[model samples]
Target: MEVIAAVAAGAIASACQNAVLSSWLVSICPQRDYAKELGERLSRNAHIYTPGSDNFAAATTRWSAAHAPEAKLVVIPSIENDVAETVKYANELGMPYLAVNGGHGAIKTVGKMKNGIQIWMHQLNGVELSEDETQAKIGGGAKTKAVTDALWAAGKQTVTGLCECTSILGPGLGGGHGVLQGRYGLVSDQFVSMNIVLADGSLRTIDESSDLWWAMKGAGHNFGIVTSVTSKIYDIIHRDWAYESFIFTGDKVEALYENINSHLPNGGSLPVDIMHYSFFFNNPEVDPNNPLIMFFIIQEGNMIVDPTYTKPFHDLNPIAVDGEGGVFTDLATWMGNANTSPPCKKAGLVNYRFPIDVESYNIPAQRQVYDLFASATKETPALNGSFFLFEGYSTQGVKAIPSESTAYPFRGDNLLISPVINYAAGADAEIDAKAVELGENLRRILHEGSGREEMHTYVNYAYGEETKQNMYGYEQWRQDKLLELKNKYDPERKFSFYAPIV
Candidate 1:
């Protein structure tokens, strides 16, 4: 047992907080000496940032201010070895540490890492393609735009999220959904291998051959800090895409879902090349009482209008239509820009995965959810800009993969519904509480409508309130297997900050 100094006694309120007492464990512990040693062990390209420093502020800036966790120090490693050495040093000092890649995570657990060290991966952003062009090695800190730009330049592409600022690996570790997921699969499905620095400061490569690879596929954040990821890539089959956007009033919610159900019966029959998504929100400019629905349809080919797939949407008589056909890269750029814009910034986002069976579209329940969203926005003006996003990505390719092959459980046909609650900074506590309640209520409604007792949630979009069964799986055997792996790989629970299973 180690004695904590009087100055650090006040910080120890929980087990995690106690982990940070490493700085005060020994009377002779030299803080500057430890930082110096870590610096010497890292490569010349590595950099360190302290609190109040310009680089530190930049490194800690997150998509949502609510998820920014304070750190005693921040280190950006240039290579995998530097990460391993930093982990080893932290372990030696008994200092708690958190690994941050894209800094877009919104779970409350992120804000709980008080007085801990932050292992920033920004300096490790690198992307390289193999000579055969079948695979690309992406650094852990590489964002969606960087990966897409690199692959686009090489006439190749991979599965990545819509937000370009989000890390390629951060979402991939849980389950990456993107425009191309309908044709290919989630980003994790395309993973070939990863270079990870384990909790014990060991550098190891996790591939399909490794027993731990299965766990790394879905619940990877709990295992280790990945330094790089190698995933399968394909040449761009069609550079241009037929993109269409439609806006509808709240009265058309039922018709909108009916059309959506008609297009995606059993959630599996949709054309793999087509991706459909809808956004429901209250825009005062559109209507004060009713929420507006913005539906987007994207097809891989360059047809000005995909007659077979997109004509039905045209029949709905959308309020507005834009962009008959455009380059796929242009579409990606547009999405990235929209997500980072001021209206979308500093928002609290949560997601729920609802499995839609054949002809199981519950219009009543969905309408209620939409109504709840409208009421919430109306009652709280601060949340008027918030919206609910329904991502109906084609899951034929996802279902093609076996459940046992990887740890991703939600591989079947499903609709990922996310409630993005936006509030002004320093908003009243009542507004924040209402936003959380609205998001959870919407999730519950969708879960019950899906006819499943246990709700399934995407790990990346979870708000840290979901049970282990919801995030991992409801089956006992699956839970046992995941727990077994958890014990084997991270018994000490070092990486237990984000959606931890232990």
Candidate 2:
């Protein structure tokens, strides 16, 4: 059966060279316990650790269906040398490489490596806090959960990915968001430096002072592989409170958006420590009539500043359900692992990073935008599980840095829109077409409605080809410099796997 499967897959690969590599590539099994084995191997070579099969499975499965079961050797490289060797071999073979720091991003580039290598980096999990405990030197392959747990153990905290399994470096390379973002800015913002492996099989340590530091923050992946990330850690004192509220359909769609936007307005009197998100989604588990807009509220300090922050939502309609919890790793766990997200069809986003300077979010065109998305969901029952996510990063820590200082352009932008359209099985053409159409349609609606198309996307969420530009709308000069660096450092482009900038 295995041989037959291999032969069949090989035939498919031969037919579609871009999407599948050669059938000769070794298969990594879901049934086998490879994570721990790989983890041990990595630990020995690099004086670091490796991840097990379960971890690898979680990451690999996160790939979109179009790119799943990617061909090529699925090597569980545990050490930096293993990674370098993998790249070197691929380069020598005139092949490409995909670096899976944490299999979270839905980008298809890595999975479409027809005849290349998949370097799983999860084994590089090393975490240590600085002597002063104000900084942490983290392994490049470490997940947000691992880092968070380490920081929490040391009585400290840092900006990191909200999803547990997402790698700090993976998301940091392109400006990551988290609950701490509202307080500490982006995870990238907290980064002090990184030990990156250039595509040329050389290692380079970068910091804010490094000529390439600024570009590395938002456009790091375009340059090389990061083995370690040094980020500023914060003093530990309080684990705050957060609330999750759900509002069902009524006249609440527009009102819900308006109210959420109001609380997070650019000029609002809300505290910088206050953060929240509104997710409009369909719940397959719930009755159809129970369609809901899930609202999440987070306050930095343990003390609740104002219940009124949720008043806008409360006024919209009666809460269908409400759940509140104290901060800690619990919040992180509740959000979910990187490999598994909410039950939604993984349609990516038309990300927007802009100040709430626009007068109203419910303008006719804006309303049309909402209606369009809502209509799309209703019309396509498959997308009923999809949702729109809008997050307001706390300005307390991030705003202090000038936007121009880093590759991220929206330092001062108070609002970020990440719309996700998730659906289930369809013809390849149909799924791809629908996903692309939805992304483009959302972009058009936002631009035409708000007259503001120039915005940065949350790289973690954006999908497909165009997301690169949308997520990194910093400046042409920055992008140009990154490309030049890519040419110089990764001239071979071995590291251009997942959302590779080049």
Q: Residues 259-345, candidate 1, lDDT per residue (tens digit)?
A: 888765536777777877788877787686878998887777765646676677778787877756777667654443444565335
Error of 1 at 256 (Å): 0.6
Model 1: lDDT of residue 46: 90
Top candidate, metric TM-score:
1
Q: Candidate 2: deviation at residue 435, Å? A: 3.5
Query: How high a TM-score does candidate 1 get?
Result: 0.90
Candidate 2 lDDT trough over 10 residues, lowest sum = 349-358
Model 2: residues >4 Å from true position, as ranges? 1-59, 266-269, 284-291, 303-305, 333-366, 425-428, 453-455, 467-469, 500-502
lDDT of each: 0.78, 0.63
lDDT of 2 by residue, 1-502 (tens): 9999999878755544332334544253123233343344443553221234554344455534445435334665565667665555556446666677756566555555665556667778899887887888898789877898888887788887677756888888877767777567788888888887777666677776777788787777777778788889987657766655565563466676666666666443447666766655666565354345666666666544366676666666655857666766766544443435542223332221121212235445546656666777676666665656666656666777777787775665566675665555444566546656775687566656666656455566556465445666647776787677777766766666556676
RMSD of 1: 4.6
